[model samples]
Target chain A: MSAPGAVVAAPEGLHDREFGPANAGKVGMWIYLVTDAMTFGGLLIAYASLRRMGNWPDPAEELGITISSVATFILICSSVSMVMAIRGAEMANRKALLGWLGATIAGGVIFLGIQYYEYNHLVHHGLGFTTMEHGNNLFGSTFYAITGFHGLHVLSGVIYLTVIWIKSLNGRYDGDASHVEIVGLFWHFVDLIWILVFTFIYLL
Target chain B: MSEQSHSTKPYLLVWIALAVLTGIEIWAAIAFDGTAKWATLVALAVAKAGAVGWWFMHLKSEYGWLKFVAILPIIAAAYAALLMAEVVAR
Candidate 1:
């Protein structure tokens, strides 16, 4: 019995507790995503500004749309897998969780691979940041900058989800999925951003 | 926590819709020109993004406060719009 006015201390192992709301971790992730949105938004807006102001190169002349389109489809499929993973987590179905997470990670990597192939192709065809077949220099710079930044995000997302995948196999997040859900938020955001990027940089 | 476990149906449906939208975007990009084309492309892109966010991300079921965080991107869009206008004006 703790005395009156005494600071009641919790037992050694039971002292730790969740310090915030049940969804605090998700809220934190959302906050981080908000900041990320601004960063990407700024870059995209800058790309738009340059396109509107400068003599932009005909993307059709240099970039490959078919490949990027396929990549975009892969990412969309990956997001579906991510959703499945979350649903699996909610049900404590380890097999579904691991399978879907693995699929999502594979999707990210394949997207990056296609991006690498595209970048190499563009560079081989004389479209460097400072050197483009078109007289305008800004076109290459903006395209590379916007798409490259997004690619980096995809790379990190792959690594992030891969960690989550391995942990799921080990049943680390059993009976809970806040962490998986948060990663799914990030994965879907990347896919969303890519949709915009594909339209702006490739299609427009 | 979700009270009921989700099925694969919704994910599958969203997947088919997104794939179809991407095909349309490609067609619009190649076929149209000028502002009309740009408008269509942007609209399709927004639709695709919305589908991914609302369904795949499960933002629809998320807490309201989290949805409110979307304001950050709106601000970004405002900034982009304003800045692009400035660039064009100059």
Candidate 2:
């Protein structure tokens, strides 16, 4: 099918036309999210297996959902701020972008902080990864592995946004406002994954 | 540049609503019992996920190909969910 501008067919799978770096970035993030979703799927499968086998202990005895819930809220808020940052960048309001990006980074840091706190809290409750409360189960391992990987992604994204934020102060990317948009896409993907994580690990 | 409006209000409002929904989730997590809690949590999670995908990620703004990209994984997730139900049900 041909459009108004250019009639370049995007083949079977690849993006049809180059959508600038921002569009490319967003697309790349979505691709990454698909793979990450599979990983979470595997983890959820494992969780189901363990729960079926009667492996998981009581929440009051083993894990803390409240902390995870709070982190979920923080991450969701950060995603909002990230969209604002992208908007600011598009309007060439460097100061507003920086402020929003800084907020995003702070949210990432707070997420990591709370993750560690929850980790320690779980350990204190006698659920430190290797130790199993009810049966010698894979609950802790799967839980830590899944959430740990997600946390690492958030950390890397935080660093990426921070660098983007610092470079914005130097006025390097004047016309490429899509860079922030791409970062927002990545950040939102991270937030989306956490939404799944929070539901599977905590609520269900 | 594309003429897409860059207003941040929709995403922001959705974010606030998600936060409130999360608060309700936590409250229901502690307050409710049995099937009621499970049903509420799952419903809220599905709603929140939809908002994030539609608004924050701008999936609603993109071409159909993007939706194709998104729906494939979700289709796989449906199968996975079936497997989960089978495993947990046994």
Candidate 3:
């Protein structure tokens, strides 16, 4: 509903010329990120309130944060790799772009691997979705729901990154490289969500 | 072009800080009990989130109005979740 990038009226219609479709892409992605932030915020607030209200055991007693931290590190590094990929693209260094994109994909795979390990570890500790040992309690439901949803997001992001990686290899981004920037925006959004999840679900 | 001019070291440092804070959070959760642990964990979380948002995501480097736009919905969603948590708890 709002005009794109014209929050303030500049004298000579500077925004109208400076901010075209490319700028719109950036702005739209930021708007999408705002909604995404809301989603994570809702999950986190639920986690906080539930933790505060109940007499639940601390997270370490049930789930281990150390292992989750490993996964967290993987995701963080992926963000770095993503930035490198964007830089490479902007520089028109196709080889470096693909290399960094490959690194980013590898980071995603490592993160997913760690998540699988954590899921199995929880299951071994009798913390599955349906087991009463963990499920009979409110803590289990809220914990699983929040973490699982975030995991699903990670999975989806991995798929998205994979697509971008493959495209990069095929020289799909040779012309404009703006696609890489857009993907970088999405990748950063995913990374941002994980930061919140690492805090609320694992660390905090 | 602008991104190239900005050093990558800051982002890397923030990432390392996030990893360390996560480790500290886990340690505190295990070491402390009651409200102390809760307080510590929440504080660490806030700090780490700040690092990620500010540096890794480049929110701090962006326009001030953009940062406000980004955070507004998050605050609103937090309130919605809080209300929902209250209802479910009740």
Candidate 4:
């Protein structure tokens, strides 16, 4: 099997680290994301069990779903932008690449902003990692843990994308987009995980 | 790389599908209750995840061990669910 981070070395005729016919580096990212999914899944499974075990608060009534849904839409849009960035990278369209990547980063930062507001709203209402006024008052801890972890991923993605955007401006991704596409994988994974988290934590 | 590999049409379609599913998810959460609501919401979430994974993430084009590696989590989740169910049953 090929080594992690080094998907089959540079082809004989090609220069170093250039993607081969398969762009297997993207696949490597996918594999990494799969493992990341399991980590989130385990945390979620524990959360589900906790909700079942406790007299948890009504998700709809206690937590703000409308804003979260809006945040969800923003992240979804970021995913779209991420794909556009990948396409731009693959086609070597620097303008489109940088533009779409900037849009994605903006979307992520906005998401974080909305989340910060949501967390503040909840905390002001007396719900947080250590305290809760609603049913299953202990639910606050798990709620924060799950969402906070996902929030950190968004923060990281934003930083990662900002770097990519800057480098794109510098012509780093002109000939090859293996790096941008990989970052897109991570960004899309964050979006995908939010889908599951939104359903399980907020909607369901 | 194939020229066809760099298209945006499929990504747009997936994005639209995801948006529509999310709309349905919010509506289902409001419209239904009990097990039906949970089922509908979960089903929609799964569909959205699949679209993102299959299209945006390009798992559809990946194959072999790469594919298996990408799919490993679902298998593990299923196993964990069964184990948890058994323990709960006891």
Candidate 5:
């Protein structure tokens, strides 16, 4: 024990003790992701439960699989590009980082565009939020609730990526990868949620 | 950190595997019906999601505690599925 009112220093190895090697930002991101996942989980479970109650239209028949499959493939491609962007950041290759990040952003934009087209097409065909021309009303509500929430995520992700891309353009992340990695976590998470959404909402 | 020196080949491989799995999912959806189709689709979707979490999210290389943190939602999902099963049983 130190003398009374003495300013004692922390032990050698105990100083700056963090949650393992992950920085606070990464840990916080993970925690946020866990919570977000639970939200999606709740929605999905509700979807499944309501689906089990019968009168649910065939997803493929109601929402064409071809377009959604294409969207899924695009999202997958964006995930790959995201990994490459992180790799570039890790290697301190500014050009590769910017290029891959740009590609990832492009993928996200195209996805949103496709989603817009799909929503318009669906609405034009009488798939309103509370009414489906050829199926149960719950289908429209749940489908919009799930995919619309995801679309908002994609939109926010694109904006986030755009900000990061601007910072990269300004040479802000030249030698530091922590920020890029943190944002990558969010972007990848959006993709991950989409995977579940596509399966639950469109395929099954 | 040392493993960071590896090339992007693994990412490419994972992407290819995801595409292939998706193709299989579409095919299964078209060719199968009933429990078989549901089982196949659900299995493939879970596998694909796992691949993304394991590789793209770097969960495979993260700390063990972080991995546990990441899997919290899976536990919740399982519970939800169990409840749904009970509902179905009723």
Candidate 6:
């Protein structure tokens, strides 16, 4: 595979690094994200199979689209904030970096709050983990399994962003923005996964 | 460190496109029915995911092998989706 920037031949006696023109940390994160994607993919496939087996209720009726759509919009906004944070790091603007990173973290916190509220509302309406009043129990099971797993991801992402934000405040990324870029990759992946989850679990 | 210049315009444009596609997705979900609805929603979701991967995740600026690394799971997911189709067709 061709490297991104201009290619230069190594001097006669020197061996080049394994990952040419790519940061090792970035590649490692990509690998981790691939595995995580597969996990979500497996869960979604199973959910679809179970859904196709019949006796499934309409998701729109059970889970209101309005609230979830709001959550989805918030995630998309957070993704933009993440991009800005990376840009800030690249430009070595500490204030911009901290501001955008804080915004991203706030977005995550709000998302989790909305999820908690939604879960509580669902449970109050009789959509328990193992039982749903006047509905198939599997709906509750698969719904929570997929969404709850994603919720955990969001929760972790918030924590991850918080750590990165704290480090940014400490000037850890002033000279090198690679770590911020790596964390940005993880954040964007979470948002990407949510795009799919929203469609499959809430809209479909 | 060498100074580098980056533009936020592209990112902003991508954000606008994503937001518009999401709005269309919601409308399609409410207005469309059956196969049309499912197809539209899936297509919109994929488009949104692609935008995030390409622009936000910087895949467009990545190396060839890295792009390959990113696409590996998509192939796997497609296979899994095919299995779901088979089960659904049964």
Tens digit of per-residue lDDT, candidate 2, span A1-204: 432332233445565443422254466667778887788778777776776676465553356676787798899989988987887777777777889899999999999999988888777766657766665547778778888989999999999998899989975444446667777878888898888788777776
Greater TM-score among 2 and 3 belongs to 2
Can you give the lDDT of residue B10 in candidate 1? 78
Model 4: per-residue Cα lDDT over A61-94, one tens digit each = 8896999999999999999999888888877889
What C-alpha lDDT values do all the predictions have?
0.81, 0.77, 0.70, 0.84, 0.86, 0.87
The lDDT of model 4 is: 0.84
**Candidate 5: regions farther than 4 A off:** A1-18, B1-5
Clashes of each: 0, 1, 0, 0, 0, 0
Ranking by DockQ: 5, 6, 1, 2, 4, 3
> How high is each candidate's TM-score?
0.88, 0.86, 0.80, 0.90, 0.92, 0.92
DockQ of each: 0.57, 0.56, 0.40, 0.55, 0.67, 0.67
**B-chain TM-score for every candidate:** 0.82, 0.84, 0.74, 0.84, 0.90, 0.89
**lDDT (10s digit) by residue, model 1, range B18-89:** 999999999988899998998999889988888887777766665445676755687678777787778877
Overall local distance difference test of candidate 3: 0.70
Per-residue accuracy of model 6 over B1-90 as CA lDDT, tens digit each:
233233887888899999999999999999999999999999999989999999899888776577889999889978997898899778
Native-to-model Cα distance after best TM-score fit, residue B45 in candidate 5, in Å: 0.7
Ranking by lDDT: 6, 5, 4, 1, 2, 3
Q: Which whole-number lDDT from 0 to 100 does residue A148 have in model 6?
A: 90
**iRMSD values, candidates in order:** 3.7, 3.0, 3.9, 3.7, 1.8, 1.9
Interface RMSD of 3: 3.9
Give the C-alpha miss distance for residue A40 in model 2, angstroms.
Answer: 1.3
Give one digit per residue, the lDDT tens place, for model 5 in A1-204. Answer: 743432233355654343456766788889999999999898888888888878899998888999999999999999999988888877888898899999999999999999999999999999999998887899999999999999999999899988989989976676567778888899889988988888779877
lDDT of 4 by residue, B1-90 (tens): 356354777887788888889999999999999979977997898889988889988878765566677788889879878966875676
What DockQ score does model 2 reach against the true complex?
0.56
- Model 6 chain A poorest 10 in a row by lDDT: A1-10
